[model samples]
Target: MPEVLVQYQAEIWQAIGETFIMVGVSILAAILIGLPAGTVLFLCRKGQAFENQVVFSVMNLFINVIRSFPFLLLVVFLIPFTRVLIGTAIGTAAATVPLSIIAIAHYSRLVEQALLDVPKGVMEAAISMGASLKELIFKFLYVEARSGLVLGLTTSIISFISYSTIMGVVGGGGIGDFAIRYGYQQFKTDLMVYMIVIMIILVQFIQFSGTTVSRWIDKR
Candidate 1:
């Protein structure tokens, strides 16, 4: 292989590793927080079990507001909190704060929507069968929406990857940061192009794998 090609491959792999780390941490946090928040949102929705407009609206406003902020800006806004949590706000670990926070809001809304997509009759049948809230949650809602949840999770992972790249602005070094630092910032056109191509390929590979697995896991 060409010397430049070999060098690019090494840097590309390194950047990919960082991206994976950020996305992995964010996805775990998103699942932990998003699932419960979504469940609460669904339960509090109008005409559902434990319905409450006040609760639903409050959560709705909060989630929407959190999700609406641009990811890069959110990173800047969360610097203090990130530093407090990670002991520094300019590394792979610190990058996870914004990634995870944004993931929670992003995935929570997706989870809520997925639950809403579950047919109302399914819940009614469960209720008539004398199901408890726990039963409804574990068996009915999630079980029925398992496929959609997978897709939602896939979406969250993709979003997390994109957001993680922006962490470069704050020195949250990753492939993106490497590209910016050595490629664009240094005016190395070839390096910049290589990074862009690798990033695109990585995104494509992730999206393809995620979609295929999600479809396979879907019982329906």
Candidate 2:
């Protein structure tokens, strides 16, 4: 194993770098897009601050329809769009497009749910105190739901990592692609085991950091 690691150290590091690129870009994009989307969804829901039946229904339908598609199918389905946007649908950059789209929707729903968990009375009290919509959302809703939001982001990050692996199927470069080419295709069990171990360690670290951060912020 030590020999093998020494032999493939450069390739392994490169693959790891590619994985981080895909996951990092996807997660960052998701947070920027999803936070607003989820907040809008929450505010526009029936009986909520900005409730509008038509807008809520349309947005809800759109999100659910996209979410209902299998990730692999979504990847294939979005190929043309990805190609048009990124010039090709088969590299880390191309892969990032679909991953970010899916992550946005996924994280949006998560954010909406997290915000929903905030007590209704909290918002009402804020309103009674002459809080504007912006103030209410930023100060009360988001502050109260910060822990849940962090955990949701954590889960989304982990999920995107898994999805990045799947990107390997479509020629998207990452550790998964490397494993497929060297580990599975070449029947190198040791390589496969290495891939699994690396993924497990990465996931464990993410989970631990997320938990610690959530607990630290959770005043309640």
Candidate 3:
């Protein structure tokens, strides 16, 4: 490590941890809630099982509205709700509230698009074989769309990292916040560049891993 890095190793590690916490929670929310929500959106579309225009329209509009907000404004707007839920609108934990909400909205839309890419023939065949909704999802739709799903998650995770960088507005410290404070404000230009390089490496690794896994699992 360079002299500058050696000087701030501990702070750098702590920032990394904070970034992980914020991004990890967002990932969990995306998987647990967003995945199902997207599935519901797909199912409720016209001519699919349990199709209901009202439900579809409501959900579609809600997701669109959430996604439409500029992220910084969204974070500021959600301060009151974040404080209510986390008892403070500042820090790593508090930052997770908005991160998770946006993650769900972001990933849910990608998931719906992924499922939509699944051939219509797959759905018809599943129905012909008397597959239950659960069976249709797990056995057919998900399997066929697994690669797209993985790619979507990969894209979402990258966006989460980008969003986490702005958490400093709420005192939510992460690598980005660390860079802005100790590196930029302190006039440590080299340190800021190093942090940016680290983020680039992290994103590259994630993209590579996600693509490899997607390819490995893809049957089509």
Candidate 4:
């Protein structure tokens, strides 16, 4: 056990860093793109602001198709684009392109759902006060839906963290890669257990923190 640790400690640390980087980049991208896309999605479906049936229909189909794809398959399927975009397909950075793309599509729906949870009455209240589209979206929609949106993001970030683990199969490097290579391939059961536990702890920490923050923000 000591020998294994000595041999692979560097690899484990490197993998942890890689995983954090991947998940962080993906989360940022998802928030940037998904929030706007989700708002558009919610407001354009059959009614609401800027409703264009054709645009909504087309975007709806596009989001659905992308979201329906399995994350692992999406990574593999986008190899060409990843390479073209990043000039490689086997590192943490390269893997992030596909991860972010999928994250955006997946979280966009979550964000839209969160926004939908806002009371129609709240929106109407803003409109009755002569709120412009900008005010409606930035203030009314977002303010009322802030709690749900935070939780949705909390859930998406955790999922993205899990997904980042699989990037190891393609040399993406992360704790998952460390587990697979040292734990599974080398039959180091203890190492695998440790890695799994670490992942769980990371997730639980995020969940607790997110919940606390959300409850604090959601003043009813």
Candidate with best TM-score: 3
Task: Compose the digit string of candidate 1's lDDT tens values, residues 1-220.
Answer: 6556576777667777888899998999889998899989999999997899999999999999988898778899999998898899888888888888888899999999999999999999999999999998999999989888888888888788778879887776777788888788888878878777877887788788878977887777
What's the distance in Å from true for residue 9, model 2? 1.4
Q: What local lDDT does model 1 show for residue 180? A: 84
Give the candidate number with the greatest lDDT. 3
lDDT of 2 by residue, 1-220 (tens): 5777788899999899999999999888888998888999999999997899888888788889888989999999999999999999888889998899888889999999999999999989998999998899899999999999999999999999998988975677888888888889999889888988999999999999999999999999
Q: Return the lDDT, model 4, position 149.
A: 86
Please report how far candidate 2 places residue 91 from its true position, in Å: 0.7
Q: Model 4 over residues 1-220: C-alpha lDDT tens digits? A: 4666667788878888999999999889888998888888888887675678887788788889888888889889999999899988889999798789878888889988898888889878998999998999998899988888889889989998888988975678888888988899988898898889889999999999888888988976
- Poorly placed runs, candidate 4 (over 4 Å): 1-7
Collision count for each candidate, in order:
0, 0, 0, 0
Candidate 3 structure lDDT: 0.97
Clashing residue pairs found in predicted model 3: none
TM-score of each: 0.92, 0.97, 0.98, 0.95
Ranking by lDDT: 3, 2, 4, 1
Tens-place lDDT per residue, model 3, 33-83, is 999999999999998877999999999999999999999999999999999
All candidates' lDDT scores?
0.86, 0.90, 0.97, 0.86
Per-candidate RMSD, Å = 1.7, 1.1, 0.7, 1.6
Q: lDDT of model 1 at residue 131?
A: 97
User: How well does model 4 score by local distance difference test?
Assistant: 0.86
